[model samples]
Target: MKRILLFSLLLPLSVSSQSNDKMCETLSKINALVKENHFQPKPVDDSLSVFVFDKFIDGLDENRNIFTKSEYEKLSKHRLLIDNYIAKNDCSFMNDFVSIYKKALERKKSVLEKLETVSLDYNSQDSVKFSKDQFPFDLTENDFDRVWKKRLRFDILEDISKLSKNADSLQLHFTEIEKTIKQRVFDTNLCKVNSILNNKNGVKSILKNDFLNAFCYYFDPHSNYFSFDAKSSFLSGLSTSNLSLGIEVSMNERDEIVIEEIVPGGPAARNSKIEVGDVVTKVSNTKGEEYWVSCSSMETIGEMIFSDHNKQIELTLRKKNGTTIAVLLKKKVMKATANAVYSFIAEKDAKVGYIKIPNFYADFDERSPKGCADDVAKEIAKLKKDNISGLVIDLQNNGGGSMAEAIKLAGMFVNAGPISVLVDNNHNQNIINDFFRGEIYDGPIVILMNGYSASASEFFAAALQDYNRAVIVGSTSLGKASMQTIMPLEENNENDFVKLTIEKFYRISGESHQIKGIIPDVFAPVLFDSLIKRENSFKTALPYNAITTSTKYNPLPKNITSEIINLSKTRIDNDLRFKELKSINEEINFTYNKPRNPVRLTFTDVFKEVHDIDSLWEKVKNATEKENSLLIYNTSYDTKKLASDDFQREINTFKLKDIKSNPYLEEAINIINDYKKFKQ
Candidate 1:
């Protein structure tokens, strides 16, 4: 898997700033490298300059709260000059931009501090509608005052609604609780402003990175620039480490820190309350020091979790159901396999082996030569020995890694053919084939995917679909077929790095699933497709294209393919849970996509609104909980291994619990059975 740079918080904050000359030198190098090596690099002209300028400004003030309309107008003078600046290796425009942005930050800091000391009128009829697109920049100083108060009032009202929901359980005094919630809102906002102003290297360091990363990001969403310390911290996540809560997180488009995955065999896996896609709103330690994620940067949040000082902590996570839950957890020593692939058997009408690959993780460390493909091969062998009639490989939420491992894993199912095609920057194509000569366990196979199954995952799934090697299931895969690799800024110097999109992957049919992604043969009610960002969600994402290739291969018989699909569709259409899930998906779409109107700040009004949304999500939360769960169990070999360790067994039990109730997996089992029946 791609290494997460969790240790960035450990880097020293009190560091000397780079000179403008130094910054320009770095930018020049980056510009040259990207243009030369990027898969489809755009020219460094007016278009690129404008993109970088707008992106930099947006990154600095995403909420459009900091910069006034006039200030923004003043800054737009250098919009078209950025390309010229880069061509001349000049830092004058950036220097001017930073000087102006700093002033804006100082002004914003003052406004926040002033707002904190006073109690705002929560009873006001005025309301605030949050929309990234609809929200306008402050037109004047008076507008700033109005907007800030609305923002603060909205925050307080939200918390009040949350606290009052449990008033009966807590026997809360409304007036006192309101005061406490107001103080929290004030403290959180002020803290956010102060942290940025107090940055030791100044805002220049942060903005400089943003400015440079704009070019890299515009090339493709995956490309990035890393400073020396940043590079080290990012690469550090490749190794197995301890003192982890056993979860991985990502900042969503809304700037909410969302739990992306729960590491198996980790503390989080054991907790029934913790789950994927929960938004972490607040974090606190046993010492009663609490930090709100809304107010803190991701780096700050990382320090709070990974720091040696805080071992016991409580995370206040906001579930999609519009409810908040506090999960008390402690850091534990976890093993490398906490993130590894594991398998189980789902028994219904037939015995089907289910293998869950968290990601296409290759052993980056020399000491551990076992890659995901090798582990998968071993799992298949065990399942074959157990006499499984069919197999299900789960790639749900797998954000893919190691292209080499994906090729190897895909090879295990397909009998010798061109698995995929790779296209380089210069328009040269190379066919990536499964030359393994024979299949491992090719008895009817099903691959499960969701919106988060990206990169190498899409590659593997697309190949199987192309050759009719496996039946693809679930909603849709994350449409990202491009490959990226890191290169040093200076030759042989590992300190400064830039991850660039080097090539794109195509199916043996020559269709590139860039932003289009892979459409499953059978569509189930998509559980995780809500706010599940995909390639098309990214503005800079590459477009889908197809090429004419001469490679020939035969697919599974048309009659069999159509028969299996029809059988599965008939079963899904009649299932109550599946119908409920589909209804839930539609409601979720309406709730998120319909233009949000200004929500009245009154407790009664806000409470009703929150309740409606919460109820909808409650349905979503329990939609897949089958009254009659599938019979899921570990294989004999895994059961024997788990028998030796209680912790491993506990984790195994949790995995089975998920497998038992999963509607997607249940349907996959049904499909596999359908395939087996058709064959007979």
Candidate 2:
């Protein structure tokens, strides 16, 4: 039967009018392109079919809130048939899946509505597990009712915990507060359902896109299918500046859009009322079109804010103290440096220069090109002027950007040589060499990285590590080494695009750190290392492989490296704050990795759970921010450069304080100090 099904899958699909023609064509095109050009493409067989089927379902009902066990079982029959369906260019299966999911959403909505009138028992000893992984899906509609009611009660209890932290200040009775909280929860859930479905046409469109994305994921995590608009957005986000409010937002557990970070020197950073953790309640575009965030999809709100069509926007933010304020913001050209490199001189035993590259952004404006590589070079020049003995390049949390920029940055450290090797799908090798002849700053150097450092960051780090130039510190880096290029499906049109993985790169040492990331020379425990989902975590990630590659470059003497690493480790062990940080990381690892117990629904028990989690992180925050022995200062060159801009100056002020308090930076400084001593 399996052999017969495989033979049938190879046949040309019969076009069905019931299915979307564009979607069918897209899947077919993506299928052909991946098989032809992807770094490593898996055959469309039962294995691929099962992966896509499970992923699509998981994407829709991640928390197991929508689909019941019975519904899932009914859908599981199609698990092995996705390969056949895709091969035939048929999207009818998507329609069925969406229909079932739609019905499940409606059922959930009905339960939410029923929950509003029903009073929950606050003192009940019943326990509910918060994570979906900790429990199973409901067996029936009756089971859904019991599960959803518990979920509603849990949400209400959490809200009450937050609202009544200062019960005396609220001055509201418990009964009235409970009623208000219940109504709010019901309204939010209803809005989430309405926004997802939108109307008759929207449900199909949203699910169709989800299906397409899931189909693409089976090839590799880097390979993705993108609509014209999404493709444009993806390209623009790669080291490009956009006109915006300069604030980043993320959805919290309650589905509320909370401000995550305000970009330094951006419009939002200047607003005193707008703060991180402030909930965005509403947004209005330049056309005076208002969108209630609770009733709208985050994508819609994000488009309104980040889209070039809107030159101005007004955001209604709800503060922690329950006060609401609306701030009008005009679009400004936020430079790449707003989130790029910032240099400081750490004065401990010596003047150690510090430079952090959060991303390797490129100059999108060809006419006036000022890329991350150039920015780092400028900072290095300033640090050189400060007469620093050694330098620490912090690449922690850098998810990477332009490959060209990464190569250029690597050039600043080493002499002209073949820095990296890229192998295409056909096994054609291409050597990426740095053409620049001389080094900018060749002093004793330490590069700090964590699991979040990926792609171009890994490329740069790998080059330096292989050359034996920079001592790599911190945890293992994110192991992505593949390169992707965007291609339009149709000629002379910008309708559909696929960002396909074209090549996988290898370090100059001929080692390919694809799934397993770059292991640091000196082991330093990063506080959030375990929480990071590395490349190996992905089920379909490309396997690690190597090629015979040769590159000639002079390396720093390797004789004293072991001694330096040992000294740094001894310092970390002896330091009181460092010991505390290590202990906190262990506790964090346990808390995050351990099987969670069922949470008690009562306010007291819920509050305790909330407090314990918060306290665990609070300890980490305090340890990292503890006053260190290093005296950090901005360079004169940077001071003069920022003298003309008040916004940049203010940002620099905050960064200086942050750098002084960073334990990791302190440790990296110590390592560099050791390197300098060993070199002497």
Candidate 3:
């Protein structure tokens, strides 16, 4: 029935006036393209042709450029519905596709206009309303975790009406839940008044925060509504994405930046008497005096931290025992130290150099010195330094970044030529450059990708694969081949705005990164397959990877197929940890088996478990008391020692080590050691 409907729709597309055979031939060609290229097609005679065409338009906008010119010409010819667009009475698929698409656009004209208003006053900071109410958000420093929850709740977006059934119901339900939240806050607020506490500051603090967050709720996740104070702060926070002194800090009773996470081999990683929990009470310039920089009363502190570029800051610290100390450190722009790991792995393979490109962000301006280009060049220098081996670019989890970066990065591997092709519904094509001037790492290359690799990562990997520079390994990458555009909510808050899918990218070979992300040449599952975080929003994320045919280059393998396979098998067999992990994961899968109805164990089962637990605890406690006579005494009740010989004699019988603390992490280390040969 569906096929008959399609055929009938095709009949109307060309009309019986001309040759019916000619119309059928056109339909057949279009079908072949759709089938061969993995292109998803809308139903014939459906309004979807226009939607696809408009979607193509959106993708080519400032933020989304992926298709090539040749692709556009082919698709444009395929767009004909009933009228002549390019040549009158041509009756080609492109003309018909365009006509149908234009009609669809006319119908959706209002919806497009409605989208324009999405940037206006969305979740503006001006709308933040504060009250004495703190219902679900009453917290001391000890309740720091609770603060995060409240802040996240207030961050919910509204204002833009969802497209009916296309909205998240859970999000809408939370909108309604705000009423009850306020009532509870009101109850708590009243109780506070009875205590005669000076909570005006606290109330004002919360109100201000709500106003700012609610404003950002109007835009995409990355868009943020910031206060004048926060504008200075966002700039500094962005520095973290680039490069900075490898330091992670937190505030204390006396507020400061306390270093926490340190990347190994980084300048600040360990070259210090400083410890993790030391507080950065104050930071000063080269002058020895402490500067009165304030992180107080502000939601963000990075503003002050990065305000002074290429300068030294004297950091005064309050130690854990309340001792004061100071440390002066110079700032250095840090590079992601991921390359060394790969280089080490490829050291043994005299024929393989490794490059793990997480994302492509090239700060290609006089403003910044280090970027994807600089980093890649440095790594290439290293690979070349070794004087041996092919190259393997590990792009496992890289989502994507700038097109310029992707293009430039792709150029590093391949010699000059066309990289990828972009095709729009109008059959327009654009050629992406593949410039390679010198120092091409022309060796047997392999690109390691997985379901998580996407976007610019896909572009880099696909370009390499298209150019025959690398063989893709692992499963199909995440198909997010589409592009997006960012439009700000207000000129005042440049950071806050709408990020929408704008365009689709096609490989030079004409493959969309959409649903079918880059398929791996070799399907080897990663070692930590059981640990992938799947309960995420990614399942609903828009198409960023789509597929099309090659625009220019065609790559073939160097016949290392059996070698890679042999290596994989040897590692799997020898690595006991991999085997154990595989076994354990299989058990976990069974534990989470989906069922039509959830299991409801009877009351008897609950009784059995509780009785067993109680018995087990009692037995353990008894054994502990006997083994450690003094240490296993009382948890809540403290025993008073008598000023007598008997008490002293009793205390002497205890051993401290007999009673153990929770040893899960240690147990894990031991387990790994058992399989250290190939698994750890």
Candidate 4:
């Protein structure tokens, strides 16, 4: 199935003037880059280095990233092999290279086979520990189909190495590699045609999962790729594909799929016939096509779900005690619970109430009139009943939703006016204006943010900060203050792309939020950074830059700006979390950012810093997770209304972490207190 590779397009990027340094300088810079990212180019053989050979291979396939800990550790240990391969200037290393190639392929197939049967025990508290625990899973597959997923990645690199010979042929091989990877999935899923497939909910979920697995493989590890359908479904907390009739699946110690949770209203929930800890053996559709999907088969089960949502699915399930039950189910629509919820916590001045904006979702048609804007308005009305003292807006981990939402939400804090601007790749501008004529939640206001507050989250918080409408608190926002909009393509099988920042956002005051996240006037440390380390951030992200000036509204009192800079650094130094973050940052070496063939002093510095940061980052992560659990339990009280009719009574209490550890909110409360007094 190898089709001719279409290489008429894809011109190589022009080497930048910055990259035009001498060979030695280039080599040194490249060395530092490699070390920072932990890359290696090993020799494939004596005739032709593996690195050179791998060039085509790398281009042909993207990583499936299903390596077990042992596999990854093996790669890490033998990384020099890759370097040797890359170092080979000529194709002298063929025989040995072939051996290495064969061995690597065998290893990848063996590992991938085992992963097919692997499923997580989400209920296990020990699950997250895998990040720290490293490889703990079992890999036990038979021979991989020729040119499987990981094999394709390696093959592409090989193709690249033999460029003169493979330029035309490699592209053909690349196409075949993709086709086989996809076909293997379809083949493997056939193993799942047990009567258990009768569950309509399970079927849809299975199908939706197919899309997720395929979609996710396209982006950088942290970034995600979603199909247009999946994207729409996710934005509104709806995944029609996977609503349970009441069965949740897990794998037993023997690697068998286990059923865990059943929803109350689900068909499985009402039947009392099925019990927890049940294991699934076979699945089928109403038409009775028995699932051929076995642990070793290469078909995709989810694709089956995609076949027909309207059809009933049948599942052949085995109870732990050894009884098998044939259950048939119809799928139903299920709503996704909001990641973050809002409530009116306290009526401070018979007018001020608190609101928390969780992660943002713009909703269908990409229209999110309610994500933050409408939610804020509703929360304000409820909080207004108390003659509220002042309001607090919490934006912790609200990585942002629609830009429209940010502007509309921010307008709720101020009296009126334009809040932000959106510019496209060509730098054309679309200005978003907000004029709030409604009851201003006019009391003393505080906007709460944390390091995870990014994108639209930062935009809204910055507006409040700049306007002096609210005193901002908590850690500095995540520096991802950029924008992107999806663009439809003419022939889209899946090539439709999103255009990201060609232009920038300027505050009403004409200040840019690029690279530099909004700085809070009042500061509180996120406890996670106190324990975890975070150096080398600049390496992983886009360069921070600014755009030329444009007209915008200015809000803050001029003196507040200077006071903020002086005070922020002082607060940061004193904060336990920031102190720890700085300690980690300072230890990073310059060599990670510079060239290192001669091993400059900078490289030495960077290596030292990396070690320090690595150690600290672990400690911080463990500390934050553990600490938040304790803090949440200790501090939050289920707030009840003084009057039964009060909306506050209906509101839920912040879990323990939300209640006790927010020194930032405490600081904001203090700021509000001062603002109230100062105005008098």
Candidate 5:
């Protein structure tokens, strides 16, 4: 019977509409492209079919909130037929899966609406496990009811906790919490329903992408399918003319839209009232039209924000200190600088220069004269003129950019050497060497990196580390050694693009930093290091493998690594701020790794959770204060006195504050100082 079903899958699929034909064509193209171009393409067999099926389902319902166990089983019947369908250009399975998912969403929405109408018993001793892993799929209505009830209770409890914290010991009754939960549920459901109903095209696009991406994942996690709209967005993001409010926003655990970053010189940065961590409660237009944006997804909020440009939008933000403020900001084209190199000098015992390369950004079109390599070279020249004793290159959180720029940047440090080895699909290796003669500043060097430093960033750091030219500091790097190239599938269709993993990068030492990232010689405490995601965390990520390289480089001084490690460890252990951060990280790890167990649904229990979180925040605040106190700005290069405009003043103040609060930078300075001492 299974063979018969597979045979039927090979038959020509019924031509329902133009959309179906287009989807089939796209899928066919993707299959051909992956097989031809992917670094590690899997055979389109039953095994791959199963993998694709599972990936597609998971992509649709990642939290396992919508689909029931029986529904999943129903869809599992076509698992072995996916490969045959793709080969025959049949999208019947894809259509069926999408239909099922849409129905499931509707059913789930109805269930939630019904739940809101019914009163939940808060005094009940029954408790629900909070972890999704505990019950990934529900078997029955009762199980879903239990899950939803528990989730609603938790949400209510969290809100009450926040309220209690603000009210200063004003205990909230169970009735009050229930009332808040009811209102929140209604609001959230309304938004969800409205979003679904209003954005049919968006929903269709997402489903199509999910279906295609599941097949793409058979190659690797990095290989992805970019739809027409997604391709446009991706390209626009890299373009210089991309317009926005200039604030990076994220949806916090509590569904609050929080400002994660205020882009320097952007409208949000210009508006002194707006700050990071500020919760956006409401957004309104100048015409008194208010948008209840709280609890909305980032996409929804973004659409509302980007609906009209050059318009004054009033934002109601709740500050971290629990104060509410409304700020009117006019949307304007952000005048962001293309320069990626930011430098400053440490005025301590010996003047040490610090250069932060956020990313190896470059204009591939060559429209601009300034690239990451050029900017870094300029900064190095400036630091050299200042007669700095040592230099610290900071790549902490640099996710990398242009490979060419990384090569050029690495060349600036080394006169001429092989930066990295690129391995193609056929296992052919190509040595990317820097032929440039003479180093920029061959002084004692230290490179700072964290979990977020990846790709080109890793290449630059690894090159320097391999040559023993720089002492690497901070947590492990992001371990993304694979190189991706975006291949346009259909020339006529702009949206048909495949970002295929075409090659893997290896260090000059013939070491691959694929899953195993570069380890810092002088390790510094990175808050939530374990929680940060890396290439190794992905199940489908490429394995760490190395290739033989014919590159020879100068090695660092013997015992330098051990000496720096010992000195840094001693300082880190003695530092109270570092101790607090370590303690906090330990607590967080414990919380994250702890097994999910049901606890009594009580106000005390909720309060305890809230209290614990609050205590953690308190520790973080104290640690930040201690670290900030130790920050010594380069008074010689103080831009505050030279600032003639509001933009410069705002940016300078932000930069100064950032520098003061940077513990990693301080450690880097110390590491460079240690290098100087050891050399002497």
Candidate 6:
């Protein structure tokens, strides 16, 4: 995962006051540390410099829409000089690049401002194509302006189509969308100017951070630099002192800052005024002085709202229904229970237990006393008391945390045995084993996983699968099996740290789940499989390797795996819900992967396209709901008493809905039931 940097509300104190001496001092320290402690250190040669140069440029202009070809050529002189510059602690190349970028931004801003005043015919047969790969930079000013105009037009057309269905209404919505586009562009430009280009200190810091990160990532994808603000946020997340309004925010494709999830018991959840998909337009202080926080990164928003605990902040949000509202929330210590282990009994032919492990969260600080391993153990004990014949541990979307917790958690299902092997760069192997003498439940266990299940989660699932203690089901897990250790540069300063990948993990079966994650024994239809993000997708990711281990574990009964797979295939073939899920997955894959031809600029064409897309998603939702109905399970919680607290009531309602609608959980329960029958 990318490290998020928290920003301060304070503007840059001095725009051109960065000292070369300070820059050199910081660079010297980083270079020395990288050489000494980096897992796979590389020599600071010309080849390394070229890699760093390209990475830095990509970080600056990711879309390749800024600096022209001529500008790039001008900076090519420093492509092979980065090593020398680093050795000498010089930043002359960075200064030159920043100067060129600022000028290009100014020119683009001027073009956007002028274009916003003119009206273009929406009936024309004009269209634009978008791609992730970098394109040739426009050589002439006219070419640059043309590229931006087409992009702006495409954005406006897309937004208008979403708002209006007919030609007449499209025109009205287009006008409104044009105004919004102009304002957003202007606001973004101003922010860049003030925070980056205009501020020498900010520019210097960014250049240093980017350059160091490029150097680190040249070794592998996981190792990178952490700025002061970023390090602070990372630490805070691991500790109980982390304070927030309790909302997960993400930037949508339309550049809108959307509320993705509301943390239970958080201020937003307590207020019940915000919903997922709400676009946050503005943020205000207690005095009602508002700032344009729309379309900003989550880190920037976190910095603005999380400055003080118990302080009130107001947000102006636009909902999916096109209604706008103001919500005031007091920032406080978010409840730890939000990430705690949660379980419920799924009653079918026989009672079965289901536990959802969000992550292997554990506080490294011994005094914290809160750990996921203990929580999961307790949940397992409770489920055993309920006399569940089978158990399903859902590890979906679990991007993993502590390795210690993973080993301990695996111990709950099996007696003492080797769980995994840790291989360091020196070719030394350390076997991580389970010391527990007794199993907690020892019943039929099914471990549910997805593409997002990574690191520690993979370790736990792989261990259980190795021991034949649990049947791994769902999509292949996220291929992230490397361990990272945070190494602080300055002994006295906690703000400067580098997360370096120090070791790789291999299962007791002698296979490393590095780039090739654990493959499920039974596969199900997963929507957005192509869109699922994973570490192996990166070109710079470390290659998968395996080391021989002497440890051995008990395997499943002969023919059991084949029997269960055959049974699952037969059941899924006749299952209407599974058929619908497959259909939904195919539609989604087709829609997203379809070719992008020239779209007629006419309102009718755009409206039809938008409507078709919306209809396809509606079918997917309906199919999902139908699948969820099969998993409906009864709960014993007293909702009437919980209804007194709005947040708790909402949480209970969500839990009930999830239990009813979870198709994956339902399948796991069915599989466990099959295993029970086989044992009989």
Best by lDDT: 1
> Which digits, one per residue and each the tens of the lDDT, describe model 3 over residues 1-680?
99999999888655533433443343343333322332232243323334334333432221111223343354554333322221233433333333433333332333323332332222323222333322221223333223222332232221111112223453356445434533433333233232222334333233223323322221222222233444345434644634455565544323335665444434455355465556665556664434332323233235335544435656666554344466666666565442322232122212234455656776656596556756777666665665534555667657678777787878877777778776553445677876656436665556667666777888788887776565565667766665555544435544334333434567776666566677775554343343343212332333344354445654545344444544554554455444443454464454334232311122222223223233333433343233211112211111232234343323222211222221111121222222222222
Q: Please give each candidate's TM-score.
A: 0.92, 0.86, 0.43, 0.48, 0.87, 0.85
Off by over 4 Å in 4: 1-104, 107-238, 241-341, 346-352, 366-369, 436-439, 491-503, 530-543, 547-657
Give lDDT per model, in order.
Answer: 0.80, 0.79, 0.44, 0.46, 0.74, 0.73
Instruction: Point out the higher-scoring one by TM-score: 2 or 3.
Output: 2
**Worst lDDT 10-window in candidate 4:** 628-637
- Supply the TM-score for candidate 1: 0.92
**Candidate 5: where are CA atoms >4 Å away?**
1-19, 132-138, 141-150, 166-181, 202-205, 230-244, 249-260, 265-300, 307-334, 556-562, 599-604, 628-646
lDDT of 2 by residue, 1-680 (tens): 99989767755243323446767877898888888989888899999888888888887888777888889888888999988987787767666687798899888888877777777888888888756352455567777778888888888777676653454444346678888878877887888888777754467677777777788888888887777553245334523447867876666645677887787767887776787779988889768698878887555776777778888899988765444578999888776554367789998888989998878988666766788999898888889998998899989878899998999889888887889899998898888888878899878888889998999999999999988888888889989989999888768657677888889999887889898798898777677688788999888788898888766666667878778888888887787876786788899888877876889888778766655565675686577667777788889887788889876887787677667777777777777777777667
The lDDT of model 1 is: 0.80
Model 4 gets an lDDT of 0.46
Q: On residues 467-494, what C-alpha lDDT tens digit does candidate 1 reach at each position?
A: 7878888887789999998899999877
Model 3's C-alpha root-mean-square deviation from the true structure amounts to 22.7
Residue-wise C-alpha lDDT for candidate 5, range 302-371, written one tens digit per residue: 5556655427778889776454578888777665653647777765667878787877888878897678
Rank the models by lDDT, top first: 1, 2, 5, 6, 4, 3
The number of the candidate with the highest TM-score is 1
What lDDT would candidate 2 get against the real structure? 0.79
Error of 4 at 354 (Å): 1.9
Candidate 4 per-residue lDDT over residues 492-564, each given as its tens digit = 4363232223335666565666556777775554644332222115333344555544545656573543454
- The TM-score, computed over Cα atoms with residue i paired to residue i, of candidate 3 is 0.43
Clashing pairs in model 5, backbone N/Cα/C closer than 3 A: 228-495
